[model samples]
Structure formats: structure tokens, C-alpha cells
Target: SLDLANGPSLEGIAILNIPSIYGGTNLWGDNPSQKKRRKAQKTKKDKDREFSNSSMSSAELAIAVQNVGDSMIEVVGLENIFHVGQVYAGLRASGKRLAQCSQVVIRTRKRV
Candidate 1:
């Protein structure tokens, strides 16, 4: 239970907006149903090095995003509008590579 200032805390399920690379493979993986599960075709040891590189790139981007979000909390409370240049600057400052993190999506959802 969160002791938030706004309102009562409620539980919810959501897939956090974590970026993923879907190269050559089908998106959403092979999840045929909610109960059954299967392995992704491209595992780390698989021959698809391109997919592996892309996965690493995406993982780095996620970390960079997490850093930026933390700074936003400290630097600008409540709201912030960041430009690509600003994001690049932050990523560069943290020594993160953006070579393969090409696709960027932005979505903001806040309740009033």
C-alpha cells in the first residue's frame, strides 16, 4: 500500500513500457496463451548475433532511460518535457550507446 498524497492506492497490472528489439522474429514472442509459455527463438547462445547485439542495445537504452527518469525526479518535479538533444546529452554524459536504439516512443499518462 502506497501512502501517497493524492488518493487511495489501488492495485493494477501493466506491462511497463520497456523497449525491446523485434528483429526478424515475430513480435510478442511465441506466447500462444496466458497460461502456456515457450522459449524465444533467439536465445543468447543462438546463432543470431544481430539479435543479440540489438538486445544489448535495447538493454542499455532502458538503463539510460531509468537514469534520466531519476534525474527528472530530482531536477524537475511534477512535469518535464525533454527534447531528443537533451536525452542524447544525458545518455552521452552517462556513457551510454544509442547506436542501435533507433526507435523511440513517448507516452505520458497522469491522473488528475
Candidate 2:
């Protein structure tokens, strides 16, 4: 299960939007059911990294931004939008080979 409970939180950031595909109403609406099932299996490993009740604050998560995407930029909060330029910073900080994370997909919390 892709345990959203364990994923990073966007509490302090100004959320612009959460992908509709990830929202409750549109679950699996973007893809065929078979594809969704396969993706679910692939993302299951990420559940282990989900946020815990004692999750670190945004500052603490700063270091983690690097590990966010394989190659594509994927900022997940609204405050992060202000630092859109820093997407490069995140790429450099992560230092992981871009080739390894080329399909980066940043998700955002819906702007409210």
C-alpha cells in the first residue's frame, strides 16, 4: 500500500495544488485500472519512508528534497513555489545521478 500517512507533509508551505490524480475523488481516474494496479505495486516500497507522527519540520526535510525525484523537479508545497529557482538547488543537493532519477515528478498540495 502507498501509505500517504508516511509521505512528506506540506504543512508550512503555501500549497498551490495537489494533483487531482492523487486526490480521493479522482483515484485511478487518469489511468486504466490495470496500469494503476501495477503502479500501486511499484510504489509500495515507498510506504516505508512515509512520515511518522514525529516527522521533522520543513527545515529538517530540506535535506530530503534532494532525494525527491529521479531527474524531474517535483516540489510539493506552496512555499516551495516561491523558491522555484531552487529546484536546481534541490537537484544539485541530491547529487544523485540525474540519469537515475530522470522521471522526477513533483506534486503540490492544492492551493487554498
Candidate 3:
């Protein structure tokens, strides 16, 4: 939460509001690459259905945000809140392209 009313009062907490996030290494299921591979192996009709439902609708995204917000507020206590209309808008304002964004990077070390 980044509500202006409570923003100034909270001393050392940072609030980040994000947009619709997808395409990552999921623990519950296959990652994007694996999904693509499986889709490739599927029949045309299956492929069509997969692509049709691949993207998250606006309503779905809203629900996801609400769910995350509720969990965060409950776990950490609510604070300042800022509402951005959409993820693309926020990224465009900052001149960032989603393709160029990388959330995390892991490096492996060779045996000594």
C-alpha cells in the first residue's frame, strides 16, 4: 500500500505496485518454454484453445491484484497506496519495455 495519507507516517517501508505479471519459472506447473513445447506437440485444435486462453483478461488481472493486495495487507499491515491504471501505462511512462525486463538472474559456479 502507498496511500498518501499514511505514506508520510510510515518510516521505512517501501511499497511497490505492479501490473499484470506472467511468464516465469512456475513451481506449480511447466514454465513458459515447456508450455510452448507442449503446445507444439499438441493438435491444431488444442493449440488454438491454448492460445485462446493464454492471456489474462482485464477482470482476471484485477482479481489477481486484489488477491495479492489482500494477502500483503494481512501479512504486513496496510500502508500508503498508489493506484496506477495499468501495467503498460506505468511501463510506458518509465520508458521500459517488458521484453527487456528481467526479474531475477542466477549464476552457477564451477567446481574449484
Candidate 4:
């Protein structure tokens, strides 16, 4: 359950168990080109460290979704399409991983 707005008033309307993803589409503050340049300048070790620090693990994702749920809001403008794309990718990846794990568990249980 993702939401575009943030307000305590939405408590009843939104499911807090689902994290909200938001990004301003206006691109007023975002500078992806600059970020790319910075990333390109990093050494292998730096890249690894950066990814390790930023990448969310499955467990972390679950905890984050649970904790932030409805409270998580991203306010992006229409121009910030990339942010929305990233959120969709993350959601798809998480869903795929969970489905795979479920299938494995079910197969193991059936064998037992």
C-alpha cells in the first residue's frame, strides 16, 4: 500500500503495514547526472562499500515496510519518473524473492 500524501488523518484510509514510496516528480532537488558522475568516480572498494551501506536486504526490507508502512511517503513531481521506476523495481524484486522462497518452503514441506 503506497501513498502519495502524508498525514495522520489518513491513518484509517491507509494500511500502515505497507510502506509508502514517494518522490517529487518536479526534480527540483534531484541531480541524477551528478550522482552518476560521483558514482563513476568511486573506486571498486568505494562502490562496494556504498552499495553495502545503501542496499536493503530482504529482512531489512520487511522490517522497513513494517515499521514505516503507511508513514513512508515520497513527494516527487511528474518529471521524477526515475524515482517511481526504482520503487517499482524494488517492489517487483521483493515480490519475486518472496514468491521464490515460498515455493521452496512448500516443496520442502511436501517432501517431508
Candidate 5:
């Protein structure tokens, strides 16, 4: 287990991430375009592979999400990680908008 009071040192840590085409559902929700792309994944994957090798040069979100996610794995707990789409769906299922559920997160984090 990780010790929160003695979090990992990062004084000289460096992370490198190669940009790749994203295939996950969007944060808010999936749309028709995404559904179509997902259904034809073999073709889309080939195109994504080409584009990633040729034109994808940005890794800002890729790097940051990896860094934060890696570091927080223990803190957040192994079974607690979830995609935002799933969370949004759960909140919507509960008859509350994601924004309303997000306020609960904000307030919880404030207390944390």
C-alpha cells in the first residue's frame, strides 16, 4: 500500500508519452459519429494508426492523464477507477444531472 504522508518523490521524474488516437467514449457521452466509428472499428483503427504515426504530435492530455492516473491508483483504490461516461450514465440513471453529481464530488474533494 502507498503511504499518503510519504508520497513518491518526483524531484527528477520525467515521463514521456507518445500521442495515439483516442478510441474511448467521450467524457459527456457517445454520439452517432462515435457509434458509427466504433461499429467499423477495424477500418477506424487502421486510419487511426496511420494518423497517429504521421500527424499526431501532441501528448498534453495523454501525458497528464497517465501521470495523474498512475500516481493516484493507490490513493483512489484499485477497484474505484471508472470512465466518466460510466459515471455520467450512473448519475443520469439516478435522475440527477452530471453537473449536480459533480457538485457532490467538488464538495467531497473540498473536505478531503
Candidate 6:
């Protein structure tokens, strides 16, 4: 249940089941040369540093949504307002794209 009349206080909230795009051969295309190029771009230490930094970074909150009406709603972070199928697009605008999002579902939990 939500009350939109008053201002929202969504802090410490959790969103689940958000759809996202995965980078793989299907999307990036299959090319041995590309693979080799990727491999050649980074040294082992560079790879290890990348891995270590990724592990240290905070996990992104996931959002899920279903088409309730006309808009595809998404619950992101602890925000009370939802984006209408624009989360993926927004991410894309920011250089991260979620590929092939057929549909979405979302869940919420409070941080303890």
C-alpha cells in the first residue's frame, strides 16, 4: 500500500526483480578477433585490479515491474516515484543499456 498524497520517504527500501541487459556474445556479436582484441587490451594485473575494484564496489539495486496499465513502471533504489519503462533508457543514456527487456516484475523490502 502506498500513499501518494503526502511526500514519500523511501529511504532504506529495497527493490527487487528489475530487468537488466547482459553483455554476451549474443548482444556484442561473435568474433574471435574481438575476443582477442579484448584480451589484448588488458594485462593480467589490470584484469586483477578491475576484478578487485568491482568486488569492492557497492551492488546496484535491482528493480522489477509488470505492465500494470499503459506504462511499464520501475522501482529504483529507495525512490518512491517510479519511471515508466524509462529506467533502461535512462541507464542507456548514462552508458549502460539493459538489452532485450521483454517484461519486468518488482519487489520491495526494508533495510534492517
Best by TM-score: 2
Off by over 4 Å in 6: 1-33, 36-87, 90-111
Q: Arrange candidates by TM-score, highest first: which order?
A: 2, 6, 4, 1, 5, 3
Query: Poorest 10 consecutive residues of model 3 by lDDT?
Result: 93-102
15-96: candidate 5 lDDT, tens digit per residue: 1221111243223222235445455553444332211233222221111122222322101111122333344444421111
RMSD of 4: 15.8
lDDT of 4 by residue, 1-112 (tens): 2221321121112112223433322211222354554554452223222112333332333222222334442222232344445445553221211100111111222555
Q: Rank the candidates by lDDT, best first.
A: 2, 6, 4, 1, 3, 5
* Candidate 3 vs candidate 4, TM-score winner: 4
Error of 3 at 58 (Å): 0.9
* Model 1 regions lying over 4 Å from their true place: 1-54, 57-99
Q: lDDT of all the models against the reference? A: 0.25, 0.30, 0.25, 0.27, 0.24, 0.28
Backbone clash total for model 2 is: 14
Residue 109 error, candidate 2, Å: 22
Candidate 2 local lDDT, 1-112, one digit each (tens): 1223345432332211222212222210122355555665565533433333333332223222233223433234322432333333343222111111123333446764
| lDDT, candidate 1, 1-112, per-residue tens | 1112332222321122222222221111222332221222222224432223333333232222322233221111111123223333343221122222233343335753
How displaced is residue 46 in candidate 1, in Å?
11
For model 4 the local lDDT of residue 16 reads 22
C-alpha TM-scores of all predictions: 0.16, 0.21, 0.15, 0.17, 0.16, 0.19
TM-score of structure candidate 2 = 0.21
Error of 6 at 108 (Å): 17
Query: Distance from true position, residue 50, model 3, in Å?
Result: 16
